[model samples]
Target: MRWAACAAGVGLALVPMTGSAQAQEELEEVQEARRTLLMAMPGTPVSSIWGLVGQLGIGVEHAVGSYVALVGSVQVSGALQGTESLLPGGSGSSGQTWGVGVDPGVHFYLTGRAPEGLWVGPHLELATYHWTVQNEYLMGRPDVPLSEGDLVTVETRSRTVQYGGSVRVGYTAILAPGLTFQVGAGLTALSSRNTNFGTPRVEGGGAATDVEGQQLLGSGFGPNNIRNWSVSPRMTLGVGWAF
Candidate 1:
C-alpha cells in the first residue's frame, strides 16, 4: 500500500510539471510568431497606366510591436511629354516629364501581426514633378517686324509639388516560406501647387518675355499654376520577400 501511495504521489507531482512545460511551449510559440522584424516589397499603383506613364516603387514595413508597423514607399515615374497639342502654334515640340514621391505611414494589424494578414493605417504623401520642353514658334512681338524666317526657339520649364494624407486598408499574404503579396486601396486628399521656373531662353529671333514663354509652352504640361485641392483614390499592388 505504501509503494502504491508513493507512485500516486509521483504521478500527481508530474502532472503540474507537464502542464507547466506545455504552457511554456505555447508561450514560446506566441513569442516566435511576433518576432517578425522587417519586410520589403516592390510595388506600384494600379492607376499608373493612365496617361501612358510608367512608375517603379519600393515599399518597406518594419514591425514596431506585435500589432503595429512602420511602412514607407519610394516611387519614381517617367513619361514622354504630352503637351504638343496644347502648345499654341508650336512645332518640333519635344520634352520629357518625370516625378518622385514618398509615402510614410503606420500600420495597425487588425488580424494576425505586423507585416502580415489584414491591416489599416494612415499615411502621408509628398511628391514633386518637373517638365521641360523646346519648341519653335513665331515670337509675338508687336513692335518687331514679321518675317518668314523670324521663328524663335523657346524652352520652357515647370515644376509641381503635392502633399496629402490618406487611410489605407490592405491584405498581405504569405505565398511561400518567405514570399509575400499585398494589395491595398485608399482615398487621399491632396493639395498641389505648380510653378514656372528658370526664365525661358529665346534663340534665332525677337526676344521673348518669361510670361510669354510660359504661355507658349502651354499650361497642360504640368499641374495648374494655382493652388488646388482635390480628393483622389489610391491603390497598391506588390510582391516581395518577408524575413
Candidate 2:
C-alpha cells in the first residue's frame, strides 16, 4: 500500500508537469503571432541609380507595422566637378557647380506591411548649390579674340544656396526580389540667396577695373537671383534596390 501511495503521488506530480509544458508551448505560439502581426514584412534598405530632378540617391526603410514604415534618403549631384560650363564655347574660363539634398518621409504599403508592393508616402527635401565661372578676353576681335596666351584674364565666381521643402507622393512596384521601380512627384517651394565676385586685370589705356560691376554681369548660364523665392514642380523616375 505504501508503494501504491508513492506511485499515486508521482502520477499526481506528472499531471501539473504535462499541463505546464502545454502552457509554455501555447505562450510561444502567441508570441510568434504577435511578432508576425507587428512586422508583416521585414525591413529593407534601398538605393537609387537615378533620382528625381537628375540626382542620385540612397535610402532605407524600417517596418513599424504590417502596413506602415519609415523612410529616409539622401541625394547628390555634380560629382564630376569642373565640367564644361553651359556658356558659349571659347569663354576662356570654365564653370562648375555641385549640389546635395536629403529626403525623409513615411511609407504605407498596400500589398504587404513592408517596403514592398504599392507604397505611398510624404517626403521633405532640402538642397544647396555652388557655381563658378571664369573668362579671359583680349578685346582684339569680337570672336576668337582671346587666344590661349592672354596676359590679363577676368574671373567671376557666384554662389547661390537654396533651401526648399516639398510634399511628395509615390508608388513603388517590385520588379524582382530586392529590385523596385518608383515614380513620383513633389510640389516644392524654395528660398535662395546669391553672392557674386569678379577679378579683372587692367592694363594699358588707363582702363578702369569695375570690380563690383563685373561681378553683377551674369552670362545667363547660372543662377543670377539674389534674395528671391519661388515655387515649382519636382518629378522623379528611378530604379532602386531593396534588401
Best by lDDT: 1
Best by TM-score: 1
Query: RMSD, model 1, all Cα superposed?
Result: 6.7
Q: Residue 82 in model 2: shift from native, Å?
A: 9.1
What does candidate 1's lDDT look like per residue over 1-243, in tens digits? 999999999999999999999999986565455434334444343222124456788888778887888888888877765434344454456778788899899989999867778999999999887877777665555675433335667777877788989988999776445677888898899898878788766666544444565565564345437587888787877777766
Candidate 2, residues 1-243: lDDT per residue as tens digits? Answer: 999999999999999999999999986554334311111121111111122224566665666776787876666656222333343433244456566767677777767436545666666666665555444443332343434222334555665566767666666654433455666676877777776645433332123324333433434335445688887776755565544
Total backbone collisions for each predicted model: 0, 2
Deviation of model 2 at 225, angstroms: 7.6
In model 1, the worst 10-residue window by lDDT is 41-50
Regions more than 4 Å wrong, model 2: 1-54, 79-91, 110-112, 140-151, 197-225
Least accurate 10 contiguous residues by lDDT in model 2:
36-45
